[model samples]
Target: MKANIQYAILIAWGILSVSCKKDNYKAPSGAFSGRLVYQGQPVNVSYNDVYFELWEPGWGKSTPIVVNVSQDGSFSALLFDASYKLVIPAAQGPFRSLTDKTTNSDTILLQLSGNLTRDIEVLPYYMIRQTKFTATGRKVTATFAAEQIIKDAAAKDIERVSLYICKTQFVDGRNSVATKDMSGAAITDPAGISLQVDVPALVPEQKTVFARVGLKIAGVEDMIYSPVQEVAL
Candidate 1:
């Protein structure tokens, strides 16, 4: 009886594989690709990801599609050629809540077709304009300015400005050796908000170190960034 069952399972598996090979299907031709921009400039999006929910009929609580945002804030996804009602999750971004439908525009839709490009403009809570690193003796100083473009609520902008030090050029909160965060106060500086980091503790004198200063919003999952700077300490 066991031998018979094994033979039957092998036949079923072979038939299933043959059927799948015969029914070759290609994904939809329609796709959505665009960059995240603020103040007419492309930006590295927070959280390094974007989540889009499908709100079509008979789609009862389906899992949302997740797209990885590139280093310079670009993203693309394969989608069917249809009008998709999209929903942005709460506390997923540094921008203000997409909720409050009565007071704000919460209905975001995508009329996407073949090779569609639609950019999403978000008012960043804080924009890191420039970052420069200089080493003096054993201490390396990171100088940068963050401009507060959008007046975020205290809770949203709760975390203070921070400077991250790492060995890799592509540095963020995730892959960092050390971080100096001004944790007590909310970063509300509309002008130049600077933070200094001691790079010698984490990096050697002959090695190349990378520094980036940014702000992590209290509720958001992604850390907003500044350009990375390389310094030999």
Candidate 2:
């Protein structure tokens, strides 16, 4: 009778220990995934070692989540149940064009539930300046200006304005050049209009030189034109 009792107690202890171990273990939650594409092409973007943030509407707060974007433009993240306004820092990533002032907004929206994958597309509007090029005695110069009429929605001219220029080139039927700070290289008029330019010495042979003039405003695309004027040496 004593031996039987001891055997029963040992069996009970083993069962309890196994039950406790099973109860304490937990499984990982689901993950979210997506790809970033532009014009039907995958973009190789760099991320700044930071996780993207998702903001809840009207909550005035956000949550940080880890994100991994592969070289092929695919991305993955772990998230919980929530509707989020996603935002990545403009300083990093292949979505540099998304940071262009012409773009309406840099933030994207996402809904996460369980393990899922999605594809995201982002288009960027580039602000370009209008230009007219002229050549004289082996000296080539391009002049750029804006054509958009500056007026408020009430059709009244605004007193103050900011304008800038960008050097542009067409690449494989797409605008590939990035807009740079041309403030020092620009010629500003008294009314605060700006122009694009190219020095004579820098002009290459038979190359189509273009300039883009951009107006400063949120959601405003660049106005671009090229009027080539040639002169004989």
Candidate 3:
């Protein structure tokens, strides 16, 4: 009788241990949320399809989170606990595909644990302008102006905008010229409204010049280049 009682007590102990282990283990099944913005405005208003992806260190499978932006540019989505990379494709039209080009895509990294809400903003990559130079016997003056969007006003200051005259070549309507940093040669005014590049001795001729304008922001990539502007020199 004594031996039988001891055996029963050992069995109960083993079962309790297994039950406690099972109760303590939990699986990942929570969600995360976030907002996407460009410059200062929301992105969903302009982009119809946005791609969101999440990756984990040892997880075998990758999870994809998709969201549709509303007219006001707000968005919400559910995600798991992992590292994520997000991208929004360019819309349709002349300006639609500007951000879709291989060089213009925006990428953001996020780490989600349990549930979270994050805000992200993307800035424009380049500024483009059209300029013309008129020469009257040794005097040359040029006027340049372009439209730009400030994705992140806090990240960029409009007062320090600079324009660069890039020597470029085009292939199939795409800039083929190897772009360089020419901001030192560009011009900026006190008001930061527009840039006027003056070529004192440049002769009267039709030449193509590329302009890039941007600002330097902390914790962000180099000043975003404006879309390549084609100017006649």
**Structural similarity to truth (TM-score) of each candidate:** 0.70, 0.35, 0.32
Clashes of 1: 1
Model 2 bad stretches (over 4 Å): 1-28, 46-51, 55-63, 97-104, 123-233
Q: Which candidate has the highest TM-score of all?
A: 1
* lDDT by residue (tens digit), candidate 3, 1-233: 99999999999999999999999876666555555455454332223333344444465656545665432335566655677655554431111222434334555556777777765555442233343334334323334443355445433333334444435421111222322222422535422334444433223443555444433323332232333345554
Q: Give stretches of model 3 more than 4 Å off.
A: 1-31, 44-48, 89-106, 124-147, 150-233
The 10-residue segment with the lowest total lDDT in model 2: 157-166
Worst 10 residues of 3 by lDDT: 169-178
lDDT of 2 by residue, 7-56 (tens): 99999999999999999865546577766656654443322232355566
Best by lDDT: 1
Clashes per candidate, residues 3 or more apart or on different chains: 1, 9, 10
User: What are the lDDT scores of the predictions, listed in order?
Assistant: 0.66, 0.43, 0.44
Which ranges of candidate 1 are over 4 A from the true structure? 1-18, 21-23, 28-30, 45-50, 54-61, 97-104, 152-158, 184-190, 200-207, 218-221
Clashing pairs in 3: 39-151, 39-152, 40-151, 125-225, 126-225, 126-226, 126-227, 127-225, 127-226, 127-227
lDDT tens readout by residue for model 1, 144-192: 6666676644435546667777787777777877678876264455365
Our tally of clashes for model 2 stands at 9
